[model samples]
Target: MKSGVFFVAAAAVAWGMGGVVASVLYRISGMGPLAVSFWRAGFGVLVLVLVQLVRRRPVGPRALFPRGWVMIVIGLGLAVYQSAYYLSIAQAGVAVGTVATLGACPILVAIGARLFLGEPLTGRAVLAVGVAIAGLVMIVGGPGEVGPHPVLGIFWALVSAAGYAVVTLLTRRYADRIGSDDVGKTLASFVVATLCLLPLAAAEGLLPASNATVAFGWLVFLGIVPTAMAYTLFFNGLKTVPATTAAMLVLIEPVSALAVAVAVLGERLGLPAVAGTVMLLAAVAAMSVPVRRGSRAAVAAGAAGFDRAAPEPAVAGASEASGDPASAR
Candidate 1:
């Protein structure tokens, strides 16, 4: 459980840095959101395929396109959430975009996990979620310059939230079946996402005019750190953590983003934002606390009833090797 929490938190940190890196790419390269998303996925797939080769895992089309319809959905979800979030940031300011998208995700996740995955919503979990959200609101306070099309930005943010929620729920539901196939799953998703975004990206200009080399370098970073490393850790963590808890942990993304803004970009962190950051961190820490052995067992039993153990040896293998699973793209 501790490891799961650590993995999720670590992934959030990487994702936060990724957002900053994407912003840098946008500034230096003049790449639109679609183009950036495309390159991110495209580069991410290359890295994942390379990793598979290094590990001697199958990189053939058969392995790259496993799991049928669920893989497609996950891939589509990845594309939607990522592109929409970038669009939101473009349309609205980063504060509004990040807050709206990530703030709504945990609520959606909690509701879905309870209804679909049969995960218990304990009082502590509920309180932690509430606190984290309230803190998030405080961090992104006021409606100062919410961009020309605030409504559209907000719409995109909500869409991103929904996409992320679906992915989290689906991933959690099939955690056992996924086993150590994180690389395969992530590679498949990136392959699908890159294909889906290709035309749109091409229309917007796939290559950057200025700082071509630097832009591609950052894009590679976005692929490696955020898309590949972060997703891998997140998927592995999902095997042990509840979807709702995982959702709450993702709040760290914005915090990490804010840190980068302040430190690297010379942005200021106001008193309210600092206090809110503390609250958010505290709430996440509270949520990561393990439940008592009996309570955890009860929750596991309830979840087992909803999720039938598939007749696959990999499922057992995944459970036994809960310490680490092969990663996502």
Candidate 2:
């Protein structure tokens, strides 16, 4: 349990630092959000590929490709999630953008799960959705001076949240069908996302110059540390921790991001925005708490499905655990 907690917390911290790293990359490299996103995904795929090789695992076409159209959908979701998130941060400060996107993830996931995955939506979830939305409104409307084009930033954040929700749902539903390989599904989805973003980055003239060593360094850090390592820790920890517990712990990401924004980047939020942040986080917490007796059972079943479909040898001891939908953010 202690180890599980540590891994989850570590994952959250890594994810939290993602925005800070991206902001620094932007400042130092003058890379657009899409360009940064492209490199992040590109390098992330490389890291996953390396992990596969080190594990002596097969990285054949069968393992890397999704069985059907499900992978394509997941890949698109990944692209949108990454692009929208970075774009939001570029427009809004990291604090507001991270809070807005991560705060709304659980509510959106609940809705997507209910509609598409046949997951039951408890009254608490409905109330959470309402409260979260209200909080989002407060965050978006609180202070016009919060960020440049705050409204647009909020829009991008919401889009990122929605994309994350869809990805979570799809991953839960099709994780079993993707094959019982070691992070094969994850690697494939990232590869697809990288392909999708490459054209956009090129068209925007956002590709990193060959001589931009510093930008490449930052991009490599973003991909290896946040994108790959965070997810690896998260999934490994899921083996010993309950999905609800993991979900709650992952909230540390936004808090960490907020702290970095204020301490490192000197960003500030108004009183209303602070209140909204509290409300949004409260809503997510409320939703994460299992009020129904069947909740644990359902989660267990989902975890079993994932294990049966794709058992990751790298975390074999911790492979029986279920996933937190919002963790995908």
RMSD of each predicted structure: 7.5, 7.7
TM-score to true structure, per model: 0.88, 0.71
lDDT of each: 0.74, 0.63
At residue 7, candidate 1 shows an lDDT of 86
Candidate 2 lDDT, 1-329, residue by residue in tens: 46766776788778767756765665677676677778887888899999999988777766677475777777888888777866775577555665577566665676665566555566666676677656654544433235677779879989987876666566555655655552666677777888988988887667654437988988888789877787666555644543434544565565555556667767676566567658767875675455447876765564554445434310000000110111223
| Candidate 2 wrongly placed segments (more than 4 Å) | 1-12, 84-104, 131-159, 180-182, 208-211, 233-252, 266-277, 292-329
Full-model lDDT, candidate 1? 0.74
- Residue 102 alpha-carbon offset, candidate 1, angstroms: 0.9
Model 1 steric clash total: 3
Give the least accurate 10-residue stretch of model 1, judged by summed lDDT.
313-322
TM-score of 2: 0.71
RMSD of 2: 7.7
Model 1, residue 199: distance off in Å is: 2.0
